[model samples]
Target: MDRRFANGTVNAAQTGSGPPLVLMHSLLSDRASFDRIVPTLSESFRVVVPELPGFGQSEAVSGGLAAVADRMAGAVDDLADGEDVIVLGNGYGGFVALQMAIRHPNIATRLVLADCGAAFSEPGREAFRAMAAASAAKGLAAITDVAMRRLFAPEFQQAHPDLMRDRREAFLKTDPGVFRAACEALAGLDLRPQLGQVKVPVLVVVGEYDEATPPPMSHELAAGLPQARLKIIAGCAHVPQLQAPQAFLSAVGDFLGRR
Candidate 1:
């Protein structure tokens, strides 16, 4: 069931019992990004998946990466009862996860970051600007293909037509203004310098063919952190939990085992 916490700043889906595990979603996606894997995760944890600010039922908050991290910390504080929890974030969620570790050091004891980078390359920044402008000008319907290209490998896109359609439908459902705002938020983000501040164990996973955050970015992120490792999921793209759940789960299982 969904629970309101942090004075309604977060609308979270909670299940199971054990050490808390918080899940955060990517841009253009909501809490449902983790839907397929939440049940499995919940078996071993108290899973708390929150709809990020400006997405799903969560209200949008002002400011950039640091501010968003603060809001996420609030959710963690309420859900974990001040106990540090494992935080798993994908894409945009990964950025927030890193920020939480940096800005709110006590919030997460371990972090699993999938398909996200510490910061965008110059070209990447331009791409985000272009995407935001496109969304602003023509709405999400006009950028479905653009989003699909970033979210999946070329082969996956060709083979999973039905899933691609569903993703497109989900994207269309999101408010364009929120999407644009998120893009802008990413455009101004650069967290590389502060990566060393995170004292928690971290696992950085990326799809082998992920076009958005790519493998090299994950390598850089893993190398920067004091306690981090990188895992690349073969035959997948941005959303490995959907495209290659078993591989993703195995990697996560191994990481959690060490912790």
Candidate 2:
């Protein structure tokens, strides 16, 4: 949980026991974001959930994509102890996961991307920048309404008011600069060309109701790699890990069990 990395002290939580599996949360979210799903995953594998730079107590990457990706890779490499790793990244963390796969395909023995967009979604990019800009100027409250409604499925919001409250508070907790740079960098990434080089098995999970990165996006990511299995979960939105834990776990667990 406490170690020095990227030339600074990194403070994050690590748990479970089995093969090491690195967990990264979505944008505006941190390691604690997996509090609900950890119990399930911890049963099968050693889970390393870190507070990504500027998301929680962690620091931000000083440079751009190269810098951030390198910092992430370094953190993993340092803490990994040279063991094979299964990476599970959700949303923005999925972007980082993809980069990790491309940057070090050998280490990422298995990769799982949940609701991540490969090619830039025009509206999504615009929305990300707009929200980042809003948060930078007027603060988080500027775009609170849209973020609350769009982050989850309609049915989810209605069924779980308490979760929505927690999510909102978490969003506010994110450092604006990291959020902005990450969003901007993701909006500009095009990994379609590099995915073919990845030799690791990949699992693509998408929420049926994910308007942000819909089934088409998952299909697109799944299409790029020769070893990817795509699954679309019903009644779930962007964050299926929390919105539909059982179904989500079933999909991911089944894949991990096999490998």
Candidate 3:
């Protein structure tokens, strides 16, 4: 069911019942990105899929990723009701979850960070900067293809034309300002220094073929975290949950099922 939290500052959909498991979507995608895995996951857990701040029905926040993270922390706290919850974030959402966990140490008991990293390589940072500039100058349309490429490999995109069309539409719907702001934030972001602050166990999963964040980034993220293990979803790119939901679920099931 659709619900609002943090006094309607956050909009989310909830399903099933058990320990709360919050799912955060990537910047290029919306809450629907988690649709494939939610039903299966909700069978054993209360699946809470939230549209990140500035996306969908959620209110926007300024002050870069830290501010965004703080806003989500509030919403997650409200959802937790004093009980620690588990958070699973994909791409941009992973960064938010990581920052939220850092800023609010007790917000989550565990984390599943997918297709994200603690810091971007110089080239990666440049890519964000360029995208932000191009999108701001031209509009999201100018970067729609680029964005889709980041999310899925060309071969995969060719194989699933309808999915690509839907994904492209989703990317185009993103608020240009929000997209640019997130890009700028990510361009300068470096979370490695604060990895020590996160005390919860983390399952870092990445697509073996992910070009956006890449497997190396996940490797670095897992290595830096206090307690983290890495999983590579074979033959998938970014958004493996969408591309290969079963493989994504299998990669995380054992860890997420732990008490």
Give the candidate number with the greatest TM-score.
3
TM-score of predicted model 2?
0.93
Clash-forming residue pairs, model 2 = none
Question: Using alpha carbons, what is the TM-score of model 3?
Answer: 0.98
Candidate 1's displacement at residue 210, Å, is 0.4
| TM-score versus the correct structure, for each prediction | 0.96, 0.93, 0.98
lDDT for every model?
A: 0.86, 0.77, 0.94
Model 1 regions lying over 4 Å from their true place: none
RMSD vs true structure, all candidates: 1.4, 1.9, 1.0
lDDT of candidate 3?
0.94
Cand. 1 Cα-lDDT: 0.86
Q: Between prediction 1 and prediction 2, which has the larger TM-score?
A: 1
- Candidate 1 local lDDT, 1-259, one digit each (tens): 9998778978889998788999898885667768778888878888999988877788888787777889988888889986669999999999999998998888888999999988888888888899999888887878888898999877787998988888888888887877887788888888899999999999999999989888989999999999998999988888899887778898899776522
Clashes of each: 0, 0, 0
